[model samples]
Target: MWRRRTLPAVVALLGVSGLGLITVGVTADPARPPRPPVDAPTRTHPAPDLAPLPRAAPVRVQIPAIGVRAEVVPVGADAAGVLEVPPLDRPTLAGWYRHGVSPGETGNAVVVGHVDSPAGPAVFFDLGRLRAGQEIQITRADARVTTFTVDGVRSYPKEHFPTTLVYGPSDIAGLRLITCGGRFDAGTGNYVDNIVVFATRTA
Candidate 1:
């Protein structure tokens, strides 16, 4: 079980300050995703701006570039309003925020997974290695596949996590894959940073 704590920044993102936070408890040092090198070349492409699809829960996520194809389970906030995560024992599963827009919808759909577990690197362990132009395919409960193109990958410290940018409403359908990264803080038993992949729906 992950040790729960109040993510004040998250609460702020929800416009409900001090209400609740999200899960933040990684026990051991796992492999962290590489940060984007400042000198690395970047690509620029016109927004695909695909029309949003009807609401449908995401059941699976596949990233061929990173060799990720994991089951996605819905996760909602607890009674105290704290956002929940996938079962700690099920590190290969990804957790989708049920309250938010589903993938292919006209909003930011957020998904999170464990970078690694006690056993070894888990789902999303190679999230940082993904580059622009790659594709992410999400299978929705409606039996439709929603495709998204990688826009960018970024890493941020937990303290300065961009809650709004990751979870905020948007005109275009967007996807954010989040996982813990950076140095593990022995004091808190948590990763010091978060790796976020920003992608926009293409089909």
Candidate 2:
């Protein structure tokens, strides 16, 4: 979904794939640790000391291959762990990852946006269509655009989300872009799966 952060992950609060649905509080205990991915790599990173995100107006998101561009909004979390989503300010960016890591930082940079809103199409609705080697760029307040490349994309059932793969500590710079996918359930009103894209930074 072109986002990575704890608040953004809160998007899952909307619900998950029908059969795989497992809300953090309702179905599963939030205290329970998320399952790690199989054959997941070990954390060899010395732990990158990170530079804080610039404070100012929010930034813009751009994907050259898809011809998609929009301004990103910063959101935080509530007492329940659900992140905030931005109001439709003209195809603008919304949502936050209040708990988890931010993009371009250490660990998994999680970003999530609406697949679609009732009123109109939302940003990241077409993110699932991105292919490997595609690039995603973000322009921060410094007026500098950071470039990222998609390395791979995978979908997982909600019941069996790879917690480690999605949230585990990393040894290098990494990313995980997530969104609902698979058959849209008519009853639950959410997708039957989540699409996660693994990416790395280029510059």
RMSD of each: 5.4, 9.1
Judging by TM-score against the true structure, name the best candidate. Answer: 1
Model 1 lDDT, residue 23, Cα: 22
TM-score of 1: 0.83
**What tens-digit string does per-residue lDDT give for candidate 1 at 91-146?**
89998888778998898898888777777787887888889989999999999998
Report how far off residue 152 is in candidate 1 (Å): 0.5
Global CA lDDT computed for model 1: 0.74
lDDT for position 9 in model 1: 33
Q: What is the alpha-carbon RMSD of candidate 1 to the true structure?
A: 5.4
lDDT of 2 at 55: 36
Model 2 residue 195 CA deviation in Å: 1.4
Colliding residue pairs in candidate 1 = 7-21
- Model 1 stretches astray by more than 4 angstroms: 1-28, 38-43
